[model samples]
Target: MLRIHFSSGDLARTRIAEEPDPLWETVLSLQQLREKSREPVLDGWRRRRCARGGRALRTLSPLMPSRGYFPDFLTPAEGSGGLESGIDAVLSTPRRQLCGELELLADHNPLPSEVRRLAEGETGALRRLGRALRDYHASVLEPGWRDIASRIEGDRRHRTETQCRLGTEEMLRSFAPLMGWQSPVLCADYPVERDVHLQGRGLLLVPSYFCRRTPVALLDETLWPVLVYPARPLCSDTPAAPSARLAPLLGHTRAAVLQALQTPRTTSELARCTGVSVSSASEHATVLRRAGLVASTRQRHHVRHTLTQLGDHLLTGVQLGRIPPPSASRHHGRA
Candidate 1:
């Protein structure tokens, strides 16, 4: 059920092996402190449960301190046995070299210009750029501390989006050949209203790089091999059975626009909603309108949007009978 398809470098591997994981130590210490603090409250049943769970619970992985260093989703749940085994496997795999390279990049302390220039045109280059941004903000940008808190929030958002895009693209490119997939491809479907039998058939090709913890595979029936050739190839395979769980969002401008309009607001309102310039909103709005979720009416020089019947129906289906009457239609898939 688990297959790792990425490589890591030597230096990152060494760092992983030698790194003094302070955060892991802190976690264990905190847990011990809590245990001592709660000793008086532990009854016989509670003590039994804690003792059982604590036997396997060993340590935590240190929080990734560098921007380029993402948690390995292939890694199993952390504990004494699993953590040690995972680390051993990672060190032995081709991924060791890739991990080493990641750590080296994290520790290199490159000049901004050099980092930017080197990473330019490389696959997942935006992630490398993000690392530079993080380092710059931490070392250089932090000194100009005007409205520091808000600035951090804004920077974080920009950093996350860029990093995700970069990572997703990189993953697709790397695995594309192995899976016969393509790069910069758009895999889309009409977001259908949910129906009976708890079935939905929309397929999403998530970038394995962005997959946290473990890769989630939804295609196991009919399309067993799921051949994805380069240059946006189409599958003649019939769609698989659907679970009630929501499908993953496609990483496109249309999805972003629809997401912005979840509040039953107008097109102009969404422009203000995202603080993006008005022109960008219009461009994105056109795509969403074509998707059949949002409809616009001209009001003087501006256009306002309300959910179409299909949109409203989709909202109900997505909510699965749990929507409150007042805000039900208004709350599309915003979050």
Candidate 2:
């Protein structure tokens, strides 16, 4: 079991990541690709990845093994910002840290020539790794990114509501079967035996679409404290595409706007995602808002639209899972 010890100040400082961490997802997805363990859910996604990832695999496979410790530097804190910044952070890892982590990896798996060069801080090897990260994300991850983001968003929203309705402590407790929250100490079943003490720095709760079995933490706890847990929501990784059930009723463009609003988007962003004019996107959001399906809030010059409860129901028409009370004991459920 991995135990995380927290202090009162740690509880006060604890918070959730604002967005998905791209590099973290990239690393976890690579693990999923190799294990092919999630069965029907990830089967199709795995197949697609296998077909397109040969070039990227040549560079990334040796660095990230099917199991055991992968380099913490591969998933930098900057990853929450986006892919470019994340890649930049990875490439900029201190040479000393790079060499040390690679040495650890080599203890278990033989490093390829490219990976060896990377450990040596060779510029060419670092450049190739960057290209592989980008190519892999573009080909393997980008396709399911929208659905992935939506799932994580749903999990975050559930946690946020729990925090507000009960309290932060209660929200923490809600993790339940996935994590045992017993006040100052949180516990979970882990692949390796380890303990993480918050030591007053607090913790960052990161929900991941690809993370499975057990939550993950940085191998190096000295970095900002993060607890990455699985956010399996709504559908499987490769759920068959939903038939256009809502499109005809709402009209194609309006329906597109509704779907794009799944994770919140500005009018311009909505326009881009739905391939509609800016004015059209704005108009649709207004219509959806008036219809009690979307909520829009102004942030400076941009208005962001998000699905309201009714809107969410209209879009999904499915019950989202809820974090059970600490007594539940069972891990995941759609309560």
- Predictions in order: lDDT: 0.34, 0.80
Number of backbone-clashing residue pairs for each candidate, in the order shown: 13, 0
Q: Which stretches of candidate 1 lie over 4 Å from their true place?
A: 1-252, 313-335
Q: What TM-score does prediction 1 earn?
A: 0.23
lDDT of 1 by residue, 100-219 (tens): 444454464433443233323233433333343233223322333232223223333432354355653333332211221122121211122211111122222222111122223322
- Candidate 1: 10-residue stretch with minimal lDDT: 10-19
Task: Give the deviation of candidate 2 from the true structure as CA RMSD.
Answer: 18.3
In TM-score terms, which candidate is top? 2
